[model samples]
Target: MRKRATAKEVADAAGVSKWTVIRAFTPGASITEESKRRVLEAAAVLNYTPNLLARSLATNLTHQVAVFVDDFANPQKLPFLETLTERLQAEGLVAVLININNHFDHVHALLNADQRQVDAVILFGTAFRNETLSDRQLGRGMPPMFVLARDSQIDGVPAVVCDAELALRDIVDHLYERGYRRPGFMTGAPALSTALRRRQHFIDFWKGKGVDEIAILSADRYSAEAGAGSVRHYLNDIDPAARVDVLMCENDILALGAMDEIRGNFGLRIPDDIAVVGFDNYELGGASCYGLTTYEQPRIEMVQAVIGMIKGRLEPETVTLPGKLVVRTST
Candidate 1:
């Protein structure tokens, strides 16, 4: 096997010090253009690359951000993850995806991230709760933490999330204008505390308009099957004449599933029989099959805010960005 070339060899070939070679490879590091060009040329010739482990040791920063996720079943998470990883890479940072599951919890994920010396930790899923953030043991020696796509009530922990109040207001106004008098909401499991905020916002916005009586339905989990089941049960239990005219779901996945259940099983025509609206404009929501009217979260802007916070370009405070309402045939 051939031995890898070292930075010292590249430095010698470039007629510069080893520190100059390091600066040439480091992002945003001060280095003369000529020196950087020589270092790159020498590095290409010798097949030399700076050791990230060594660099982390010297700088005390790994340039790695730990992102904790658990809700892989939801399709909306895929787009958010793609946007987040791409943005992190663009900022010269790496993302360490940690799965929070039945066996491993948020506290355990926090410990692992801290042990790995990650520059920051991002809670990107519903698995993390405010109680977990308040854990004293997990707080010690922990890296800077932020919440993405969800609101954080814990002080000192900033969050980048969609403006739920504005989204819900827009949704309610649209529904009211469309003559949707009786409104209903479909949510995920009880464990999803973050989703409760959206549900409450939906109810509050409706009540503000004097529509006091709103129906609520909850799924067993954050999946299409759970959503379908919840809709099935609600339809079976409610009288046809008193049923809700419009259903607002916590997410696109639930709305998609509810639509399928409503049409496929009950033979109900969308908008003619019942209108549906959802949050998070997933790709399939735009498809002709579903044509789901949903709210589009400002995913790119939210991810950029997170990167800005990491780079100190923005303050580490709760940053709420407004999203747009997407109208489709479903509504």
Candidate 2:
């Protein structure tokens, strides 16, 4: 087996101190261009790289951010994760993804992240509850935490979320303009149905406009199958006259399923018999087959805001950014 070159060897080759080599590798560390060039040339020749573990030990910062995610079934999560990870990498940080499931919850993930000595933690799952943030077992030495893509009401914890109020207002105005008097909302699992305030905001926005008796349907999960099943059940339970003119879904995946169920199973014509709308603006929503009219969350902006909070450029408070409504044939 071949021996790996060390930093000391690189320093000797570069004719500089080991500390100079360290500064050359460290981002934002004070080092002259000539010194950095010498260190890099030596490192390339010797195939030497700084040990991240040793660097973290010396700096007390891993440059790693733990991102907790659940709801892997939802396609929207994929784009958000891609955007977040790319952004984190661009900022000279690494993202440690942690999956939160029934077997392992947010509390468990928190402890695990803390044990890893991550620089920060970002909660990206909708399944997490506010009470979990207040859990006594989390302890005081836990790393700084932020909530992404969802509203967090826990005090002192910053959340980078879409402005639901503005989104609801835009949706309601568009629906009313399109003559959608009776509105219905399709929500995800019971755990998330209450956790996300979009459902309540949808109802409130409609009620404020004097549109009473908004119908609500709950899906078993965030999958398209659950969405299709929820629509199937709702359509079968209610008479045609009592049906809503437009159906709004919590997310794009649910909306896709609902459309499939409405068209494939029931043979209903979209925008004529009923209209469907969704949030998150998943890429599939723009397809010609579905042409789903959904709300486009400012995903990039929201991610930048989270990074800003992490970098101390922005305050760790609830930051809400506005999203635009996408008009398509479905609506």
Candidate 3:
């Protein structure tokens, strides 16, 4: 194999010092236009490219972020990750995606990104523990860390999340206005902090309204199939007269699944027999077939907030955005 060209070779070919070659390649370094042009010409001739890893070592910034995610089956995670990567790319940053299944995996991913000199780390899933993030036993010198979509507080870590408690209040109010007295919640897993909070919020909101009876069911996963299976099981045992008037799914995908089961398998009319609602107003939720009544989770706002935290525009504290309701044919 041919030996790779070095900055020294480019400098020699350009008739300039190696310092001039380095400055010319640097984004905002002080260099004369003529020298930069000559350096560019020499680099082109030699097919020389700056070593980003070496540059990061010298500057102490990689312009690379590590994103830790889980639950590949969740329909919303892909879109959320895509939006995050695109926004980071727009700001001249690169994203390295790491799929972690549990808290131990999260720790490993963090350590690995730190070793690789990542500028920041973002947790895009629900399995990480807030306490584990700040444990002193972990190695020192971690990059700026954040959690998205879920609210968690570590001393130096911030989370950009929608206000789920407040959002559930809006959902409860809407359900009440629509004459839904008996409501139920369908969640993927109760182990997740986000899911637990959302579940409790629904129960507390309904109890506060003097509605003592409510049903809550947890699916094995967040997939549409799981949603359909859980709903099917939920309806089998309940008496027809005591059935839940409204079923509030934890997310749009789950709601979509439940809606399909109710219409397709159970042969029930939406909004007439059972009004269905969901959160995270996914794109398909607004389609003509579903027209789901769901909460609008501010993805753009959360992404921008994460970027601000990465750039030090915002402090390391949780930022909660309000939720908006989109009423459609579902409710």
CA lDDT of each candidate? 0.89, 0.90, 0.85
RMSD of 1: 1.8
Each prediction's number of clashing residue pairs: 0, 0, 0
lDDT of 3 by residue, 160-216 (tens): 899988999999998998889999999875444323378789999999999989988
Better of 1 and 2 by lDDT: 2
| Candidate 3 least-lDDT 10 residues | 188-197
Model 1, residue 249: distance off in Å is 0.7
Q: Using lDDT, rank the candidates from best to worst.
A: 2, 1, 3
- Error (Å) of candidate 1 at residue 179 is 0.9
Per-candidate TM-scores read 0.94, 0.95, 0.92
Q: Rank the candidates by TM-score, best first.
A: 2, 1, 3
Residue pair clashes in candidate 3: none
Pairs that collide in candidate 1 are: none
Winner by lDDT: 2
Please say which candidate is ahead in lDDT: 1 or 3.
1
